[model samples]
Target: MTTKANFPVTAGSIVVPYGHVIGNEKWRGSEIAQRLQGKIRLIFEDGLGLVDFHLSNRTCILYISEADLVAGDEFKRRLVRFRNARSLGGIVIVERTQISDQYFLAVQKLVVLELGMVLLPVANQGEASQLITQLVREQSKDHNSNPFLRKQCSQLAEPSLFRTVQQIPGVGKTKALLLLQQFGSIHRLCNASVKELELVVGQTVAQQIYSFLCS
Candidate 1:
């Protein structure tokens, strides 16, 4: 899984699987990748990482094909490890199909519930590019806001878990405090499912909260 020769690192550089560039039943060929080369950078990488793709700012993703899902327990085991590693802040999964029930449950448990990874069932590279763009923009906004807000800090203060939880969308200071009290820790709160979050914050806000945290 070595990277392609002469791959350039540029603005919005994203590492993609070598297989996708070679043309698969689902991905067709390098044409899609070539089309995207102008707007975004694409680097090829060996299968060293748990994720299939990676962004410059640490967003990683696993593109799970239907065949990968049907391959049995190996994928599930890897997913379990990937979830618990908590290596990246925001990760994603791009799948052609929704996946089988067993794999779907695994995704619900490992990716969505345990690891909090964004799951995108995209039909083509164009849709994937859009999601990637949205992720980069959101990450940029978070990165840019932190420093400016830090400069306005009155003094160096101890970090509060409540404040951290409030960073998730729809979780204001009040809801953040409540979540901390209910869950007892940030880890537990993040591990809670969207359904569980709905119990705390209601349906609409819960979905938004999950999307913000996972994305």
Candidate 2:
């Protein structure tokens, strides 16, 4: 019942082994833990404090039962404590049965909008187990496997480059085209000296371009 904001455990301090989930001892005999057995290795630990499950060093899960939702604002206060503790990236898994459905929106707003934590609704403990399996697998995979985390190969369009170059004072379509032709790219053009720019445009225009770019 002690929802202390100053819980000693922190996300950075906990080291979860690869491909394994460190679950709080409270979930040892629960349905979610039973279902997660074959899918991913689950290890139980005592005194996890505010966290229900540690998916990784940086991420953890806080589960809210139907009973918790029906009880009152205790879950909200617990979430607030967890958020204030700044322990980990808390992913809240809440029961969303017809009985608890009414409280979902309010819980979502507090968990996602106010506390800035991830909120996922499960119909029951069985569904919660499946979601936890997927999360554990995602955490175990190499970061490069994720498209968003992968290195992107970006190529700037010539039309966009031409338009950007023309934004410089005294630079029109003709001078922009000429500068691009001489320098090949905006990076090279920006590095070009006023003397170098004189070759593309006149001395006065070159000074203006140099000043516009440098300024």
Candidate 3:
């Protein structure tokens, strides 16, 4: 349970999960249409579509009619708490839609099962579930498995670093992201001396960063 699970479990697969949305009245139609359009585009783009969503002003509104929401680093910023995200339109579409709490968890859980995290129940419901389970099990086995699958395996099919950066001193969300963008790797950035770090973060911050990392 502690090890992070991923999403999509596997390409071209899924189950009948529950879903709904809540949002502003003025923008509902536009938002719903946008969601549907995005689903269509994404399915064709990467064979993936909306899983679930909540209409709390806690997230940003993505418009497909005029504004582009795909690419340019698409992600659900988990660290930041968002609010006041009312959908702006004449129809009151989902200020938020297509992604719900359960769907997210389900996708991640399914990914974990795929990554050999745990053995779960047969979610197939009829012959489909049994067939899917068999296929997944046969595709991956604990012992004597293919080396490529283990070495190149990924959660939700997205690339991920095996180590956690949360415990790094002075490396909160913002700083961690800054380092990731600047240095492109944690080990390399951490290996920097105070003087070298100063070139990038200035004298005061460089010292603080070095001390925090070396600590």
Candidate 4:
């Protein structure tokens, strides 16, 4: 039997149930649903595996556990779906510590920077709601006037330096900004050394960044 349900309209918002629902007694399952009341047009979907919440702006927040993230080919395939989805501003992955190093590395190279998904490390699923809410708020604001949103919307249309630079191996949104400040351009940053990157970011992250550049 199909688990999918017709998108339900409540208080003028569309609530669609999309995935397999495994509920515990604690209401942890409906955390997004509760936190997002009256915020957007779409409802919190229970079935979406790649992203826990998809906003009206098409930005999605994915809350990943160790098991779901390390499913090898399956994981990569889901990421591909996120990449191909239309109207995507960006994707956010809320990470847990149980994720294996290999899976984390794959996500870093193939999913995050390449696909324009953001990586947010959270202590657990409980912390994802606030972050998701924050992203929704930011995205729902003025697109034309807000310089940040304007830039992000342009990024949604096509890859921009604001977004593309983050795809570099170990670089994230923050690190990407730092690299831009240090190197003044993506071209120069591409040739940056482990030592130079270390001075900007840190030793461990620099090593990872340099290794990814080399590969």
Please tell me which predicted candidate would have the highest TM-score against the true structure.
2
Write model 4 residue lDDT over 127-205, tens digit each, in one string.
6656555655554445564433322233222223445567566778888777766775444665788899999999998
TM-score of 1: 0.49
Top candidate when judged by lDDT against the true structure: 2
Name the lDDT of candidate 2: 0.73
lDDT over C-alpha atoms for residue 70 of model 3 = 29
Cα lDDT tens digits, model 2, 86-174, are 64667788998999999886786576546655577789999999988877766656655643231221121233345445656799999
TM values, all candidates: 0.49, 0.63, 0.24, 0.55
Per-residue lDDT tens digits for candidate 3, residues 62-138, read 22211111222222221111112222111101111232322333323222222212112222123222322233233
Pairing residues by index, what is the TM-score of model 2? Answer: 0.63
- Name the regions of candidate 4 deviating beyond 4 angstroms: 1-28, 34-51, 85-87, 99-102, 140-176, 180-208
Candidate 1 residue spans exceeding 4 A from truth: 1-35, 83-86, 96-105, 123-125, 142-215
Residue 1 miss distance in model 3 (angstroms) = 14
Task: Indicate the residue-level lDDT of 146 in model 4.
Answer: 41
Cα error of candidate 3 at position 60, Å: 32
C-alpha lDDT score of every prediction, in listed order: 0.51, 0.73, 0.31, 0.52
Q: What lDDT does candidate 1 reach at residue 213?
A: 55
Tell me how many residue pairs clash in candidate 3: 16
